[model samples]
Target: MKTPETLLLNQEQIKSLITMKEVVEIVDRTSKDLGVGKTINPTKVLLDLGETAAYPPYSGFMNAMPAYIGWEDSAGIKWAGGFLGERKALGFPYITAMILLIDPKLGFFRAAMDGAYITNMRTGAQTASALKYLVNKKKIKLGLYGAGMQGHTQTEAISVLFDIDELRVYDVNRQASEKFAQDMKDVVKGKIIIADKPEDAAQGDVIVCVTQSKDKFLKNEWIKPGTVVFPMGSYQECDDEFILSADKIIVDCIGQVLHRGALRGLVEEKKLSEKNITCTIGEMAAGLKEERIQKNERILCLPIGTGAMDVAVATAVYNKAVEKSIGVKFAFV
Candidate 1:
């Protein structure tokens, strides 16, 4: 008898197997499942490595995220790391990761694949799902802060879900903003404009912040009523006033949002509490909680990037790869 094999897929192979539309669909379904108590996603575990006194100022950390989707009987874990101020020296990405898929019934390892792409796309897809429920407008003016990898995917996912008349992008690096605008013009029909400041981008119909800044750049005054804001960059990009002023705040996970999500600072500052959050995006998607009831209401969504998304997307990708015979198979046991 032949030994069972595991599929190994690289970044390009994973990209070829998955699409933005498919990501949105799977993430949306996972969120709905979460609302109805049909999934198991544990709180992410982190190990913080403080910066050293090196010439390049090296700082490092690692994290492990695990999840199980009950509807699909799929499970997996994603192990990722970040090395700030050292990517150029190391000739690698600032962030890197891999996902390991498991057979839920047999508890056997089934596949392993690159996770960086999955992380970005799933984060964007989750935001896109939030928009479907939180933003009532069919046509919107999209604003993006930090036009990099995450920004590109967020724009891609949102464009697939909404009709954007215009896209305003802002980055600390003017060249990056120009490059982003030029790159995205072919993908989305909306006119892309480079903004001079983060405030300019915050005033759009749908505002997404994907920067790595530790300081708050988005102010309460910059956000207009009837706008849907996604603070996906954790608590780093949004000010306390901006978070407190929202009519409704929805999070991907209540446990994570309270501890590490966009509201973490507000929660620690004693300005906001758990009661302030209206509901999770899961609840809204499952019809357990109310959505945007008024056009003039300002709604905010903070998704901390759940492992359920990773597992779901990975499972889908693995199944597709198997069907298309796109990845290498190696003996596992």
Candidate 2:
């Protein structure tokens, strides 16, 4: 009898297996599936280790996100962890994670791979999916509030979908924004400008805030009436007023958003409730709800990042890797 082997895909290998364009389509379809109840994405389980003597006043945490997509017959869980103090002291990334893909029928693990890149790309793809339904304009002036990994992918994903006439980026570290412009110069066919302030970056047709700041830096007055805003960060860059003032608020998952995403603070404070949400991106994608009906509607999209997206993209990547024979194979004894 032959021993079974499992596929192992590293970050670079997985990157070569998938493209941003394909990821957008996958995430878009996943949203529709979610709307139609074709997926199971449970709430992410989080474990927080409060400040210790070694890292006093700082904290570490880990989260387990699990999902199953019925249409694709894929199931997986992403396990990720991060420590703020370690990032600052060790000069390491704040988050690191991996995904384990399960054989839906056999009930065994089939593949394992790094999930950090997938997480960033899928998040951007989710934003693109929301933009497809919410933004009516064919061309847009893009405003970016952070120039980190998420910002880079957000710009890449959006530029893949729409023609960006102008891209204004702002970051506390000027070098970060400069690097972003340089890295994307060949990719984005538009004028890329560095903004001196967050407000300057917030001025555009479509604004995306991806900062990790705990305090709100985006002001409602800075946003134009017709602008579409995507606060994709972890409820860090937006305030209650900005959220409440939007004409239509769309979320990836209402349940997750209310407790973990941009709306978490508002929900906890009783300033906003699920009733205020216009609809889930899934609902809009599935045609169960209307998209931007009015030209002047200020639409805000808050996607907390879902586990179903991880499974969906991971499944696609795994299939592609198998077809291309891209991953390393190890026998399971």
Highest-scoring model, lDDT: 1
The lDDT of each candidate is 0.85, 0.84
Tens digits of lDDT, candidate 2, 1-333: 464588999999999989999999999989999999999889888666542224345566667999999779899999875667756588876667899898877767888999998999998998888888877787888999888888889988987799888999999999999999999897678899999977888877889988767678888888878788888766548767778888888888777788775787788899889899888999988889877736667778888888899889999999999999898988666
What is candidate 1's lDDT per residue for 1-333, written digit by digit as tens? 454689999999999999999999999999999999999989888666643224434576567989999878999999975666657487776568899999888777889999999998998899888888876777778988988888999988988898778998999999989989888888768698899967778767888998877788888888888888888874458777878788988888888888775787778888888899889989988889878737788888888889999999999999999999899998878
Which residue pairs in model 2 clash with each other? none
Off by over 4 Å in 2: 1-3, 50-58, 331-333
| TM-score result, candidate 2 | 0.94
TM-score of each: 0.94, 0.94
Prediction 1 TM-score vs. true: 0.94
